[model samples]
Target: MKFFKTMFALSFITALFIVGCAVQQPVQPIPDFSPTTFNSNDYVSALDNFLIILDASSSMDDRYNGNKKFVTAREIVKHLSQTLPELGQNAGLRSFGHSPKVSDKLTVLFYGMEEYTQKGLNEKSGLVSRAGGTSPMHTALTAAREDLKTFSGKTAVVIISDGQEAMGLKLPITLEAAQALKNQMGEDLCFYPIFVGDDEKGMHLMEEIANIGKCGFVTKADKLMTGSGMGQFVQDVFLTKKPMVQAPAPTPIVATPPAVEKAWVVGEAYFDFDKSIIKPAGFEFLDKVVDVLKSRPALFVKIQGHTDSIGTRKYNDALSLRRAKAVKTYLINKGIDKNRLSCEGFAFSKPVASNKTAEGRAMNRRVELYPVTK
Candidate 1:
């Protein structure tokens, strides 16, 4: 009886182990980030060259918030690539971990120290397949120092990692490497470290590395995954706001005839699908309109909102009105008199472009400004 009981217990234990091994944790889906188009007229590239250091060490295979850290890190790079405007800057991507199939080296430069393009960077980022091997972050940084040497301009070093290294390893080695890179690049080098996990030690390590660069800031992967978050990050890293030139003082008054009635369709301002918020790309056009309105206080302007024919008429009507009001509110906040502005919503009634194609739909979702003689 005792022997039978022992056999049954062993069988049960074996079954339990097999069940645990068979069940895999489901990875969460990364939310799609709608990148905002940045107008070149309002900003210029801040850095001449930039390098992205991604961590693909074995540790990244571990899951954080239901998704593998490696996947999240890769997504962050892709989204950043999409958000960054092609302003003729040099770019490169390096990975610390070895994917046995792709490379046998401890570190590899996957992409350019060449001119940056949204498509080119994304294709190279996709080439980094699997994550395996120890974190040799110091070695990657050392190679990156050499990578930066090939180009001359203000540069940014963006490191994306979980901040965890091999057990029993001394931490100072990583910092020393970062410091050395900084010493080589001098004031032109900035460090932007993106922490990928919730590990406290990892966060601190990433923060310390950024501190060493002295010119950049630290952010988390989850925050950068969002559309607005990535947009702000890109704006901070790559572009500097062009100084707003003040309108020249009005010339001594020569009596001018009443301004001819005019209408301006701000097709230059494009809206994201199903979104009503004014994008940064649209701000420059609106600011010019603000100058126009302020200069013509006697003119009453009508703000017209339109939308693509995707939703029901009733829903599109409300959406369009909300869009109109959004522009109206923006104008009011900019010190335009509320009494002079009126809003109207034309929901798919006016087709500036065909609703069948995406390009046409984007053009359809726009605001028009009409100035009337008071």
Candidate 2:
């Protein structure tokens, strides 16, 4: 009887061990699909025509930060053209620096969006390689305006230049031509200038162009023209619905008494050129502000919007307000009190950084948050 009992006990123990092993089977992890399809067609599409005007002037040959400006611009244009879904929208390519004759002026490299049936950007064969001369930016603007004349949809002209109008055919003539074009086009078309270098004079020219064209101006290169910058630009233009403007750098935070009755958090949020909506990556930082407001139940925040010295002051001012309100709304949705927040737009009147370099302009486009404790 004892032997039989021992056998039963051992079998039971073995069975329990087997059950334990079965229960210990590893849990398979779910593959992350966020990065893969983050920008996929999950949201409603806002299709718009993109005209990429590249500055292929010899000056573009100059190294910016490290890479050649022209090369970086080409990479950005090509990637956006290929990756962004067709959505019934087309991309046009033009250049200002390459003319068979120095006087030929800004040449149309690729006219409008055509089906991409070729390999690479055809660097050696395209007008980019063939273009080497003075930059006729104004002429390029005129040509771009003409190109958009036929299309009735939303048109955006993206000029990627080093911001130097010095070597152009004639400065006064070009400026006059651009202004005339703007007068003819009215507000139907948008012009966005992405200055590549850090020349103050060049940035001023770009700012002038933006003012005349009533569009956004961006000066800077982020992360070597990888898809992120392009994506940010596109998102800013379409999603946020805020017109682009140049702004100043953020002011330093001043020390104040902790018992100060009230304070207002005011700041502007910067977006990619021609883009209005905030990128997802920036959401975390923005959310922190909301969290702070939630923690301080008695504190009220006022958001002030500002733009760099670009585009019409009226438009920038309005856009700045809209951008600030957008943030306020976002915070409200995140559980902050709407009544506690107020928004104001300052336009290009306030500038913290010189709008000369690409980096400086980026610093200009931002939202200011102030706390009001009264």
Candidate 3:
């Protein structure tokens, strides 16, 4: 018995020596961030309230492209933190599959649902040192109900994940949780999922999750690999793109009198009663507007959305804005430059006709296009 014990001890000592000889590389320090070199402020955030849910499960430690997935994701998150346009949004950072187990209380809020800043996010992101535990993304989604319960206006939930939930993970619960969040937030909520690697199944699952929210879409993680790439992603997901305004096109027909001319207005476009839906005739006219815009490339146009006064001022304003956006979307679809088009919802505030009668109200519900001087 003593001889056998001695042999076993010798074997253990040899194994320990071998393990100690193996070198573990130190984690590389993240590159220093330059705000001026990477800032994107030309546009503003689209969301009034937003949250970033990062995946930190063990799977993230796996390799992707060349580096570890977790490191790549963390870098992307850091870049986004630095790149997000400040639009007075209440933003928070949450992580699931990070705790020892999946639990309601395990969903950790590192930053806040408070006013967002790049510095604050960078600090919060530093708290996540490594990836461990199983992914409980559903629990994280479910937790959003409480996190965004009080905030109002357009909300965005940006989810970054490799998209692979743990085996036997509660995926159905995730779908259900997403639906519940939608029901609670209504049209105010949007989901933008970012995939870290080429996992088709994981990507599809994320796509389905985004579809449940009914807004935003699935995007690849590598899109934020560089400063310019990161800037573009921030602009796409967060910033509200500004219209590309240029100097007004010079009139070829020089009149003898140098008098100011009124801006061109497309009066043929009309919206239905109490609705923002544009008519087929309106679509056709907008196509002509597109042709003119294409022809006069130097000019920017403003889309004025108006509504009948049948509804409250607040309701009318929103409806008119939707109508304006609808018109802008049509013009964009017809190959018109988005940067050259701007929209302003006037609601019942700007009425060309009387709102006391049906005929006048019908005329009031219309969108007008006006040329903008540079």
Model number with the top lDDT:
1
Per-residue lDDT of 1-374 in model 2, one digit per residue for the tens?
Answer: 99999999999999999999886545433221111122433332233455778888778877665566666666655555544533335457777776465336456656555422223233322546543677667767778667766554445667788777645345566668667766665665566777777888877777777777776666465432555655666555533222334334344333221332443233334555434565464566567677677778898877887666544443466677877877788888898878998988886567677766655666666677777775
lDDT of 3 by residue, 68-99 (tens): 77888888778887777565678898887663
Clashing pairs in 3: 244-339
Q: What does the lDDT read for residue 227 in candidate 2?
A: 56
Scanning candidate 2 in windows of ten residues, the lowest lDDT window is 29-38
Q: Model 1: per-residue lDDT, tens digit, 225-324?
A: 9889999998888886644542222222222222437566654455655568886656766777788888888978898989877544544667788888
Q: Candidate 1 local accuracy as lDDT? A: 0.83
Our model 3 lands, by Cα RMSD against the true structure, at 14.2
Question: Which number leads on TM-score?
Answer: 1
Cα lDDT for residue 186, model 2? 65
lDDT of 1 at 225: 91
Question: Higher TM-score: candidate 1 or 2?
Answer: 1
- 100 in model 3: Cα distance from truth in Å? 4.9
Q: lDDT of all the models against the reference?
A: 0.83, 0.61, 0.74
Model 2 bad stretches (over 4 Å): 1-40, 44-47, 99-106, 113-127, 166-172, 238-374
